[model samples]
Target: MKINNYQNKRDILIVDDLPDNLRVLSEILIERNYQVRKAINGKTAIRAAQLSMPDLILLDIKMPEMDGYDVCKELKSNKKTAEIPIIFISALDDTIDKIKAFEVGGVDYVTKPFHVEEVLARIESQLTIQRQKKQLQKEIEQRKYTEEILHQSRAVLSSVLNSSLDGIAALQAIRDNSTGEIIDFRCLIVNPVIAKVFGKNKNDLVGKIGIRKIIDKIDNNLFNSLVKVVETGKSLSTDLYYQCDSLKYWFHFIAVKLGDGCSVTVKNITSRKETELELKKINLDLETFSRSVAHDLRNYINNINFAGNLLAEEINLDGSENEKELIDIINLSCDRTMSILEGITQLSQLKSEPIKPISFNLSPLVSEILNYLQNNEPRINIKFMIQDDVFVNADRKLLNIAIENLIKNAWKYTKKTDETIIEFGEIKSTEKLWQEKIKLIDISPLQFKQKSIYFIKDNGIGFNSVLEKELFTPFKKLHGDSDFDGTGIGLSIVRRIIELHDGVIWAESQLNQGAAFYFILATD
Candidate 1:
């Protein structure tokens, strides 16, 4: 994994009483791309290691100052150097000293005049084991992080559902038994906002068998949006303008797919909507009037200002009056519109903004995304193989978008599998090693040209290999929209985000098997 700097060579400390032994070991480790440090005796070894920690240590069993067993025990006692693995090398082949070497925290024991191959193999083994332990620890921490995010999200959702000003309802789709058509939605839960809007008791609506004629006048457009979300399991957010005999309002409707149905939130945005329209019309008419008329009207503003002072003073006398409520609403709407316009202006010019990159761990981020996906489909028992401590240097926001799209894509494709397994990890730096270890997908998409290749793999309904070239093309699809309900822009968006970080994405798959996506970012 790209947990740390993979380009950096491993460091090894060799301690021996004889200069010749240290020289020989140093050369061997250096040849294998390891940074080697030498100390002629135990005391010197301990001092050198305490000053600069090495990845692994080779210590002689017998020395003038102190034996290797004592040296190992002392090193293990120190918190900073405790994790460094030590392999004891000495002339003493006695089994008793070997047991003592292990008792004192020596990872392995090697006799004197050991074969070069055997010594190298033992050293590599110890280092590999140490790396694995660190990886496991990171994975455990990431799992905890995912659980915490899930718990916090559910809590916040509960709070919003219970206390939000918006009409909130939990619904279950009533489907046709034979053809699986969502005929209507049954209210599984409802809050006071929703109850008040429909003019029904909360208790009465809890088990209602259909979309409870919202406000006694449900529009066709609103009904269609609800059905579409439940059918396709997609989210919907729209500003809908509604008008009736007594009501003229705009509602912001948001529907998110929950289980077999969807949760809906209806926000009344009539005041803001009306203000926006009124201001736009006034600005248009004023500019036109300026061009048409001969008079440059400065006196009109004074007259309006004088009228405003009279209106404000009169309204302040009766706070419950209609004029007072209208003034309050207008003031609120103006302030909200200003803030919203500022945000919209900034967001619209996306290319003008430069990305801010930072180095961070990917394990927790991927875990959080996976947990969210699992919650959406609580019935799916997906086995996740998330590599630990995977670190990346990129714009966190852009990278988050990339990771979420990729993971959500994987989650969607794997929905049909009887036994689902999704993996988020990286290919090893060596191609030969990772090729053999890449089992997350049925077919391989493993490319280890870089030091490491980040990957997200899934055992899902894979796409056609012939469409590989179009995988990241905007709106290009390997599958029909009828079969998989998506605009086919998800992968394209992921590619754009990855490209912004100076990276490339690739995919490979066999039909009906599985697919794997690989990406590698350029290092600074």
Candidate 2:
């Protein structure tokens, strides 16, 4: 049989042993625009099915070599052609045969001596039914694929949460059962590990707040992070080192953003933190040991060189002046080593000591420091402006050290006939922005009725302006040792003190012009 010339029509295989029947069916189907193929026997039909993969098969029950039942069985047995609908066409008009054909995977039957109109109608009806079945099967396959993806996604999320070394939780957006209002309070799922850590069951926590409410019960930081993640739908991560009972744990938690909710995981890094602390302790001990050895060596060398200088002075060397020169060299070297050792020891002390702050009157303290500096250097004139009745909360000793260093810096760097001007006062008002309100800071408390703005200006031989940032670093020298007669740790000490007091200090200078230092202390 030849196929009809139909555009995009479904391919059908007609299998019958009769030549007249095959010819008639082909001519009628060809006029109906269906692309049909023919086979005289079941063997030929199965061969054609494998070759062309027809969308439908029409088989005659009584045939030579192989019957239609065997052919339909073969087609239905194979996975490739099982879905193709099979309709039986035979002369026998028995209902038992129809049931048997249906059981063998025959979709419909056509009687022998078939009319052209009846055959075409049956063909059209079966084809329509087959198309619907194929569509339904396709939809079922697509549904299965979607379901597999969802299961894989859940498995991936579960593995990620379970494999985490830190405590983690996941929440979904659901309505509150009691209030009947939509809220981000439901726990869709939780891994087994988190359940064990929190001492809860995953089944019991399905509709709860997971670990967030549990943490809130214990007044933990997780509550805040959970709120932020839920409100903004953004990832929030932080390092939290906490102790439970006697065991210490360090956790870095990250909340990943998701639609309608978030997935949070925490990585426990207690071992890493312990390693860091152990390294820090070792470095501290080494630094302390180094400083101790340096101190003892400097003292011993200083004493030996001092005795050599005295002996060289007492003994007269008439022709050996080189021996005295060597003694002088030893003394100078010892002095330099002692100075360096002293600098290191002082810096170590600064790092070790805690800031001890107390309430004190800053006015009298500043005045006393200035008076002492003035008496020591009478050649250099001093212009002082002190803010009266000003008080602040700070360590008086540290503040004195800081102010004295600045004064000394001014004195050492100022040119000849230069005057140092020091003024003191408070920050008036500062404005801060917030989501709902603006905050204003008034420096009227602590009896500092007038906001203080302390400044030190000098007509000094200023150094390079490029070293502004490194000025507060220890041993960061701007002037040569031959020109300046002091250690370079002065500004560093000043910066440390200012930071301890929660204040800010900065310097402005130009090459050979002058230098000015400003200190702003928050009084309120």
Candidate 3:
């Protein structure tokens, strides 16, 4: 256990009439890293301590001027120093004096003709108790600070989130007190902004099911987005165009995932969303007009070529070859224009498409994808070791696209001397998740027949470990485009798919050594 910085040192004040007794006590305490403050008389002792406080006080019961009782009373009178522990050390054998010493705020008494061991033991015991007391004080202060922070945080967050015209809420998973089993999570806190959007009071929402319970009462589109944030554990900021009570309203929501909970702020973006829709509609009309114009021009060019053939039959042979060359150029230019238009249309379609999840066996998909790559490229010896029965509930088409991209890159980047190897399987255990996250996998779960881990290993030209963070980002390429031909979207897509399935993806690699992609596909 580690002690805090404030409570690391002990301070002891020894007040005695005898210089020899003070000297002996000082030596014993200073040897143990205690700061020793000495005073010859009661008056001097109080003055010495007032200048700098000590953790524990050792006062002589009998003194020449202003006895120990008077000194203890003065010290205890000041609120700044009242809590300090005072121990009486004296030659008085009478129980009445001992009782009087305690009445003046003394904690313990040391009988006269002090044994070195006895003094040391009592000092140790008092210091131990002082340490414990200081620790408890620190804990209480921390709890108070935490409560204050929570209170302030709740006020600020609620105020900011609820003020928006868009409905926003916070939700946490409720658990059973006895068994820790998850019960239904109800809304514990909500802001006024959320209340106005749903046409209800904040008090009525204390035990409700967040936005899910009243989405139809507010806006169904906003409800769907709230659901997305809960499932994904990712921040969502989007503009929604929907209707509530037969009146159209656009809401922009910014939701942050809080690990089994969430906090969202909604902004009334109705005007902005309406403007965006109008602009989009204008752009669509322009696109339709362009396509129509292109189609009309193609027809006009065809008619011109058809008429040019009739003119060729009636004209003389002079300049005929040049005329034919001009006609051929016109035809090729039209063809190129059509191809460019088609490609643009395809790119637009890919951009606007939504992501959908579909389930399929990954084992056959991996094998078939690898077989196709190997068959096309005979020189690359692709060795794949997939645990046969492995299956996952995810978007098969997207998974195939991601795996194929990784496999293709692996083949492309294989070192001349190294054999390309790929492996996959499932891992299911809390211990394994910790191990994989912290690089200290607990193999103990294997003895008890726990869920096994699944991983993907590959042997290819690896990059620096320092660059792993940016690897999954869109258009972030570790290797040059010429060295490995890619648009830099393969790993980005893979990460997106894994994220969609609520899984974690990480890479382990070193320069010149191969890399492995490890991911855990959490099952429901």
Model 1 quality (TM-score):
0.40
TM-score of each: 0.40, 0.50, 0.49
Q: How well does candidate 3 score on lDDT at residue 9?
A: 66
Q: For candidate 1, write residues 322-407 as lDDT tens digits.
A: 78777665554444444334333323223234678899999899999999878887744669999999988888887897899899
- Which candidate model has the greater lDDT, 1 or 2? 1
Model 3 TM-score relative to the real fold: 0.49
Which residue window of length 10 is worst by lDDT in model 1?
343-352
Strongest candidate by TM-score: 2
lDDT of 2 by residue, 17-108 (tens): 99888888888887787778999999889988987798778789999889999999999999988888888999888998888899988888
TM-score, predicted candidate 2 vs. hidden true structure: 0.50
lDDT for 283 in candidate 1 is 65
Cα RMSD to native, each candidate? 32.1, 13.5, 14.2
CA-RMSD of model 3? 14.2
Question: How close to the true structure is residue 232 of candidate 2, measured as C-alpha lDDT?
Answer: 81
Q: Tell me how far the alpha carbon of residue 446 in candidate 1 is from the true structure, in angstroms, after superposition.
A: 48
Give candidate 3's error at residue 7 in angstroms: 13
lDDT (CA) for every model shown?
0.78, 0.73, 0.71
Residue 48 CA error for candidate 3 (Å)? 3.5
